[model samples]
Structures are given as structure tokens and as C-alpha cells.
Target: MGYLLITGGTGLLGRYLLRDLMDRQQKLAVLVRPSRRQSPHARVESLMQSWEKICDRSLPRPIVLTGDICTPDLGLSPTEIKWVVENCDSMLHNAASLSFVSTGRDAEPWRSNVDGTKNVLEFCDQARIRNFHHVSTAYVAGCRTGLCKEDELDVGQEFANPYEESKVEAEKLVRSCSFFDTTTFFRPGIIVGDSESGLTFTYHNFYAMLQIAWTLKQSLTAHLEPDGRTNVSYFRLLADGTERKNLVPVDWVSEAMATIIADESLHGKTYHLTPRTPVTTKLMCDVIQEVLNLYGIQFDPVPADVSTMSDDEKLFYHHMQVYESYWKDDPEYDLTNITAALPNLPCPHVDSAMLANMARVAIAGRFNWRDPRVAADVNLGVPEEVNQPNVVKNPS
Candidate 1:
């Protein structure tokens, strides 16, 4: 009678995970923090209603527990704690801070990534949930080149940012917990939109470049020629165009992780949810140029001096400074674990056309630039707009 307890049920991949698992009729419960505008149960209802709109059917809802992962005992009441102890046997830790840098020890990347994970582990120990699943990023390999196998973690490699460093510590903490019967790790690469629909609830990583290109295109309108191509100043990127980045779709990652979790035989091993063949930077730039009708984004083998750069070039670098390390070539990810577990479900190849489609969708949606749509007063009866999953603002 015990159910699987999931954290981060409102995140990008978390939404898809809920949908995929619910489709399989697996008993589930979610731990969600109340937002400023909505209670915990209201947020879960909104998420479920959004998924129902997507599938065009009614789906069973999971019990919602109101709690903040960073708080002591996960901010759960005594009764709620008792419910978890009595009704939950396993857990999936998906909540995390995605900030690339750390402002301070109490600030992001550490607060949510490290401290929050410690709290979750404490709660798990108290609740006695034996099976633990942690969602880690493949970038935990951190600035490492060559082949990064599934079993590899902390090889004295340098990190590109604080986010990677925090996640590595969190994974180590989970592994250090001695009471767990099974420990599983899911490390996914740069996650993009859905393969079939090209729809994404969250926009980061690849979308960052596309958004910059779109803004650049708008800024240099007079430079545009009759052929609709802009004769803008070329911005020199740090890397050559040949570097490849491992990008994977969200749906594929969710499905693969769900499959492994449902089968107890696949527990206790790390799974790399990465693409077989990664996409090159040149191809991504080409797709952006073709979709946005903009050009002059050239790559240089060596770094260019900032003083010698043009105004437009400087502007590009200024905006892209945070994500500078992300554009580097990724290592060949060993998919031995995922490949064997889900032979029939293969990772979708992200070709130029697919990238183009995703770029267009992001551009058309205005890169999810909008005000907070969820109001303080929410009607529980799913409204017409609430029925549309795309319009449902993510609380995370």
C-alpha cells in the first residue's frame, strides 16, 4: 500500500515524469512547497489539470504534501510525517538549484543543491524509505574531456561553475547514506524541448543562444539587406565551430528514467541519459542563422581580445559571459547502462532540422517572456486557459 514519493514535481522534467508514471498506473505522491499565490494542493491540482489537457483525459491525482526541502524535517507537520512514514517506501530526489554561480553559502546552488539535499536525506532516514533515486546532471563530470563513463564521479576534475560543484557534493551525500537499500542515479545531458512537439516548459542552455541571436537580429535592422540577411559585425566565440555538445530531449529522459525505476532489477546503477551522437556548435549556429535570418556569428580557434572587439561583438560577449563554459565540446558519454535497460527506446538524434524547429518554437513563444499568470485566487474547476498546459506558469 506504500507509494513512491517524488520531489520537484513542478519542475520541467518533473512534469513529464509525473505524466509518464501516471500513464503506467503507478501509485505516487508529491512533496511541493506552497507558492505565494497558491497552496500545495492547488499547485498539484494545476499541474495535473495541465497534464490532463495535454492527454485529453482525466488522470488520478497523487497525494500532495506541503513542505520546503530546505526547512527542518522538510517543513512537514507531525501528521504529514506520520503519513510519509506509513505510506511511502521509496523516493525520487529531483529538486535542485539550477543557478550556474554561487552568490554566497546561503544563496543558490548551495542552499538548494547541497543543503536541501541534506534535509531530504534526513527526512528519508526518519521515514525509513529504503529505495532512493537521485537526479544528477552529466556535467557533474565537470570540465573533463574524453569519455565519461556512467560509474565516474569526482576524479579531481575542475568544475565550470558552482552548480556542477554543488551537485557533485549532493550525489556524494546520497551515496554516503548507509540506510538505503538501493541507490540509483540519473544523469541527463543538456535537456531541450520535446522531440515530437518541440515544446518546452523551461528555457535555458540552447535557448540562451537562440534568444541572444533574436535580440541581435532586432537590434541591427538597418544593417539588413534586401535579401533579408543582416550584415552585422561578426562576434568571435571562444571555441571553434566543430565542438559538439551533448543535448537530449526531456521526454526521452523521463521515459528512460521511469522505465528503469519501474523495474527493480535496474536499480543500484548509474544511467547516462545522453544522446548517442552529439550536435556540433556549427550546426546549432547554422540553425539559428537560418531560423532568425541573421548572420555574422563566427567562431575563432583562440580567444579574442576584448579591447579590439567591436561594439556588437562586445555586446554579444557581455550577455553570453555566464554561459561561456557551456559552449565547450562535451565528452563522449558512455550509455552502456541506459542502452541495455531500454534497448527499444533509443535517444532521439537532434539534427539541424530538429534544432531549427525548436528554435522557431522558442522564438514564436517569445522565449516564455511573460508575467506570472497564476493568480492568488485560483478557481479549482479547470478553466479553458488552465486546460492548456503551455499557458500554465511553472511555479518553480
Candidate 2:
């Protein structure tokens, strides 16, 4: 059967991408690493079961094969490579490692994010895949902090961490891989949870800050210092005034990407999938406060200053910095091509309240926050950024 070959088929966006194709009557054959040992369907089945509580279960299933992008020709045997060449009509390269901190000296990011692209390209050449779709983070534009065009790359700006650097390089790989008849890249800014439920598959996401706050609320997390203003705080810098964060829900991301790839003319175009009305850090923090209050957690707001955190806490705080700027300070994206392609499809637009509702679902047990370890799966994970409001505990 002709297939839509997808890399990272079981990832956050890959699941949505596969489902979109299936919805259009497209067969999916995703590439999996041989190390998985088990059949690809079984692996995805296990993973989906684990994430079912977190990720939306509306996606369709697909065929899977053990393949690794890190290896030559994606580590596929000559026969397997030829199979794709003749059977797969299009490919979506969505697998990438987003480790911002491990850039300079760490080699894994480059090997997987950059060289992985090279290997995939070689395989595509061998397979002569008809079309290629790549899912790249909008951060690839780097620290330009201004309007970024869909066609632009190598914007003159410094990157915050290795993850950004690696994405930049990986994108370069996709751009140069012009062997396919058509190539398209979709760059999304700081993806959060589902727009409807604020659902997310990965724990490492926009709510990372809230998780930090909840952790610190369990004890002193860190001291936040003043940096600038954001709307949620009413433009009032937090007690420890610092830059506010930017966040976008995941539903918009997956749905928008699904919409973008449907157009054949959009094959070589780049589309920036971002919110029409942006949310600020202060508003994001406010929603965190409400979620905590919803679950009866308490704490006091303190400006977070990494310099003041204990050695162990400092390590955690450092990770927080990776996603901090990306969400709050978004990169400019051109969406004209996408709007032109799908006129009725709603763009991935979101704001603080929409984000808050999603957070509520995540904390309120609409999907299962109970990890089997936490005494109360019912607890709303929030830190004391605002005055601790008195409340009751989870019933169960």
C-alpha cells in the first residue's frame, strides 16, 4: 500500500500528524528504532496506554518498522529502503531532541537532531520519496526578537542553549535536502497543552514552571527577581520581578500542523503556527495560582533568583531557563501561506484564560494526574506565587 512514512510517529505532534493522514484515507508506516525489539504497533500501544491519561486518544494508529535515523540510510536494510522508495509517497520528519542545555559540548543533540536529518535525507534520496514534511520549532530563528519570515534561516542572533543551536543546524539539513519533489517545514512557538483541555503528553512543557512552583511550594523552590513586566501580573513585576513567560496550547499546534500539510502547494513553504493573541508571563502565573487554589494548595509568592537557591534547587532552576524565554518572547512567524491554504481552518490562537482552562484539566483529574505515587492524584500542582488561599484537599 502507498504510505505516509513518519519518523517519531509516537511523539506529541507525530501522533496528530499520523491521525490527520489517516483521516484523509492515508496509510501510515512510521519508522521506529530497532532497539525497540518489539513490533512498532506494540511499542506505540504501550506508550499510548501510558500517556492516554495525558494525551488525547483521538489519534489513529499506524504501521511501524524498526529504523534509526542516527545510522546510515536511517539504518534500514537495502530491501527495507527500497520498500519505502516504491511504497511510501510522502514522509514527515518530526523527530528531534529538544535539549537546550546540552549544546556546546554534548554530542547527542547534534547526532540526533542534525545528523539524523542527514541520514533521513540519504534514505529519502534512496527511496525517492515524493514529498517531505519537517516539524521544526520556531526557535530556529534564534534570538532575533523581531519579525521572522517563514523563508528566513540563519537569522543573525545568539541562541540561548544547545537545543536551539541544534534545531538551527537540523533545519539547515532539511532546507538543503531538495531532492524530494516538495519539502515543507512547520515552525511552532513554545507549544503548551490542548486548547480544549490543555492536555499534553510530555511533562517537560509550559507548565514546567508551575511544576517548579508546586515543588517549591512543598518547600522553598527559589527566589525570583525582577526583570520586566507581563500582563497577568497587571504589568506589576512579581515580588522578585523577572521576565514573564510565553505559552501556547498543544491542540493548536497539532491541529494546525495537520492542516498545513494537507496542501500540496505548501510543500516547500514554511509556516509559523502561533497565537493570534499572545499570552504573557504574568497571566500564565495567574492561571497557575488559580489551579493551585482549585486544588487547595498554598504558598507565598517570592521573586525567584537562582543565585539564592540551594545547590540542588539551582540545578532545577537552570532547567527552567531553557523554556522561559521561548514562551514569553516569541519569534515572529509568517502564517499567510497557511491561511491561504486552509481558509476555514482556525489558526492556533490562544490566550491566558484558554491556557488556564487546559491547566485546570491537567490538575483537576479530567485526565489522571495521579501518578500512583502522589498521595493525592487530586492535588492541583501549583506553587505559592500568589498569597496562599485557604482550601480543602482532594476527595478520594
Candidate 3:
């Protein structure tokens, strides 16, 4: 069997995909960028160890290639490039920037998502890799409401942030590339922790809200009397608690994508690895209240101006400004392609119970801020401490 080249093998979904592919005894090559404290090989080894612990079984190791996606030829040496071209027949491009705010035209989200994808495509073209798997996001539908079909790429819609816009551009680049005879796009919804264990390395997006809720609980508890109930009025935009947020477990996405990739007939199609029934904003709020033990939590419309808002409301908004777009209703994602491919495969329901479990895990892990695995070396462009939550790091 020809080796498969995977990028972002250390990321949330990438880790799961690595495990699945390894379990199938597939030979793999992973392109990993060197971190500040560890080499590319070390990072892949650490993640493999974590997976072994999670599964209680040894996994086949992947060949780690030291490279940067934003650079030409993936910053690969002539020997490394030749080795990949000789050994690899398929490429899974999964690395991307998750920053919501754009620093500039040449900075993150744009640099990594757009430029990095172009570089990967160039490498694939040069290497003569015919099969390509592009990991994308369901939010590529952008600000469009209603159902988003699997085949649609650009709908002339506005994006909530630069991240969405960048992904759309990346997908377009992949589609327009003519070197690959078979290309598959896997678009997943908001990916959280594992469904069973709730284990996750990074905490942003949905988890960011949980972190803010934890912060609010901490701040309010410090000010409250010993037996006083913590009551706070939360500010929400014009949402009436009916907006739906599609959340999928990381494991499901990886498994589904792996299954699709293994089947040669399933190539050359876009699949939405999304939930059948999306969780509502109201249900999420109720679960948060239950998990954090907050009483008298009320959601009010965001004022026209921040000048009249209370300090607590202002702090909450400021902390969650980056994810404000997620608070809005998500467009319906059509999963007909996925369902037709695997009729028996069903996406686990992300109900209130699951949300509670995820919240508990986040609270226990402290949003992975102090975890040794994550603390070893934070991803590029992510700060050690984020005073303002207007930026998202390592988005899935």
C-alpha cells in the first residue's frame, strides 16, 4: 500500500485520524512543524503516547517530516521531498490557522489557511499525488441561513470572521487544482471533545464560552457572601434562545473521514460530518447553569451601546467577543453524502447531557491551560495568556 501524507497530525482531529489510520495498519507520513520546546518528532511521539493511553493499545508510528505549511515546498529539503514523492500516493491536508481575527494580509488565518493550502497543493502537484483529502469546516457556508448543501463552495455570502473566509478560499484552491484525480472535502461542524471521555487538548470556540462561564462563576463567588446565591444578568444579542449550534464530537469526525478515505469509491465528494439534530442556545444555557451552579441567570438583549452596560456584562462580552458569531444560529448542513456512504454510521447526539459532560471535563482540565501536554509548546501565533478573548487559537 502507498503511504498517505497527513498534515496537522498533532491537532485535535488529526490525532484521532492518526489513531484510526494506524489501527488499520496504514503506512503514514505526517508533516509537523517544529515547536519552540520540541522537535516535530517529539510532538508526534507525545500525541501517540496520549493515544496509546486513551486506547490502552500500542499504535503504529508514523514517519514524521519536519516542515512548515506556510513555506514553499513545505520547507522540505530536496531529500525529504524526493522521499515523499517516491513513497506517498495520497495527501490529507488538515493543518490550518484557527484565528478568528486577521492580523493582516500576510498574517495568520490568511497566511496559514490560504497560503499554506496553496503551498500544500503545489507540493502535491509536484509529488504527483493523485488522491487528496481536504479537511474543511461546515461554516464555509458563511453567513448564509437555511440549508447548506454538501456540494456548494461559494454562495456569495459574507463570513462572520476571517477564519471562515480563509477556509472558503482554501477549498476553492483545492477544487481548482487539476493535479489530483480524486479529491474529497470533509467539512465538520463545531468539534468538541471525545464523545465518551470528553478528552480534548485545546479549548476554544464552544469551550471558550465554558471558560468564560467558569471565570464568571469565580468572579461572582469571590464577591458573594458565604451562603449567598450567585445571580448575574448575561447579555445576549437579539437571539431568542432558538438558534441552533451544530456540534460534533472529534472522534466521530475522524472516524467518518477515515472510513470515507479508506473506500476508494467514496472519493471525489464533499461530506458534512455534522449532527442530525443541532443543540439550541437555550439548551446550552440551561446546561451551563446546571454545570456552573449559577442561580438566577438571565439573558437579556445586548444594548445598542456598551456605555450603559454594567461592568460584569461588559467583561463577559469582552471576553467572548471573538466567538460572538458562533452565538448566532448556524445554517442547516446537509449530510446526505455521508449518510449514503455509511448508512449505519450515526452522529452521536450532542444533547444537554453531553454538553454537561463536556463542561465538567473543561472545568476539570481548567481549559487545558496547565496540562503538561499542551503547556510543553503552545501552537504558533497563540499567546501564553489571552487577556482579551477576541481571538481564537487552534480552531478545528
- On TM-score, the candidate that comes out on top is 1
Candidate 2's residue-wise lDDT over 208-252, tens digit each?
Answer: 666655554445422333532211211112222233333456666
Best by lDDT: 1
Question: Model 1 off-target regions past 4 Å?
Answer: 220-222, 369-396
Global Cα lDDT for candidate 2: 0.62
Q: Residue 291, candidate 3: how far off, in angstroms? A: 0.9
Total backbone collisions, model 1? 0
Top-down TM-score ranking: 1, 3, 2
Candidate 3 matches the true fold with a TM-score of 0.90
lDDT of each: 0.84, 0.62, 0.82
Determine which window of 10 residues in candidate 3 has minimal summed lDDT. Answer: 387-396
- Candidate 3 wrong stretches, greater than 4 Å: 220-229, 234-238, 301-304, 369-396
Q: For each candidate, how many residue pairs have backbone atoms clashing (under 3 Å)?
A: 0, 26, 0
Model 2: worst 10 consecutive residues (lDDT sum): 374-383
